[model samples]
Target: MRYGLAWCMSTFGGPIGQALGLTLAEGAYAPVAWMLLGACWIAALVSFLDGRRRRRLLASQTGLGSLRAVDWRQFEMLVSEAFRRQGYTVRETGLDGSDGGIDLILQRDGATTLVQCKQWRSQLVDVRLVREMYGLLVHHQADAVKIVAIGNYTADARRFVHGKPIELICGDALLAMVRESQAAGTVSKQTRRRA
Candidate 1:
């Protein structure tokens, strides 16, 4: 998915670019040659600009909230839009007790995924949320359970997801998905309707 691609690009590409800069600095090529070579890097800049433009288009269409005014329901809607943009058939159930701990159910390629959204602004998510989601996965017989915390997770919470069937998506990860979905030009119809 584009979200995964963007994460990989930012993580790996940063180090690669730094190494390339070091290599260029130590090379036999003169300053003039380096300057000429630097001009070729304009392509990368253009690509980045194009991506930014596409993200702006998506933001315009989705009408996402800024950090200053994001509400819980809006955060949930954003998560739903993110999944839908990734080609999943998403069904949001809101805060219902029947679904156990699952907040949203998504289906794609015959696989059912349960999602839990936490829209905390300051508090760190704890392990209880992860454990509850694991139990809900069993109750729902879902293929996977994803816990999306719109804030940082505590150390224990992160450890709980490691080596478990449940996946933890932190605030940064969710934001990255939204940004990537925007860049990919895959805004969800739900978002458009809400707008």
Candidate 2:
């Protein structure tokens, strides 16, 4: 249960009521004063109840652990789409245990890039995955190796890719880029509409 929004609304309601009451008190006749106060209270009550109900519904739909596990294949598709938008020809290699840790092989501008997709829950990606991809890149003579973790990354994992040409896309960063792309499309539509 997330009560933070409810708590803030309750806390702020007191000061808001006081300010509104004081303002209304200074105004006109008895009927108008009563009506204004009643309307304010009703609006506040409706808003609070609506917020509570919405929160409850959202919580029920998406439980606390809902974000923990995501399908790796779906994530692979998302990454492929992301790369495609960047003008790369992406290929899904499935699980190649012998081919090292390469899960996706991408080609662009005659340069081949190896990508490993890890769809984890709250687990932090460690340095070992990075090392494995680095070995695969060298073995396959790939121009670049990318390790995209669809979750958080450990400090060591970040440090491991710091100097290397390896790219790391955490869950939040990936989502942000997707949002940016969506927003760009929306803006383009609006511009065309204005024209």
Candidate that would win on lDDT: 1
Query: What are the clash counts of all predictions, listed in order?
Result: 0, 0
**Residue 135 C-alpha lDDT in model 2:** 84
User: Which runs of model 2 end up more than 4 angstroms from their true locations?
Assistant: 1-70, 95-100, 181-195
RMSD value for candidate 1: 18.4
Q: Which ten residues in a row have the lowest lDDT in candidate 1?
A: 60-69
- What TM-score, computed on C-alpha atoms, does each candidate reach? 0.60, 0.56
Top candidate (TM-score) = 1
Global lDDT of model 1:
0.71
User: lDDT per residue, candidate 1, 95-145, as tens digits?
Assistant: 444545667999999999999888787798898878888888888788998
lDDT of 2 by residue, 48-132 (tens): 9854543333223222143234356555655655565566887778643453467789999999999887778768888888888
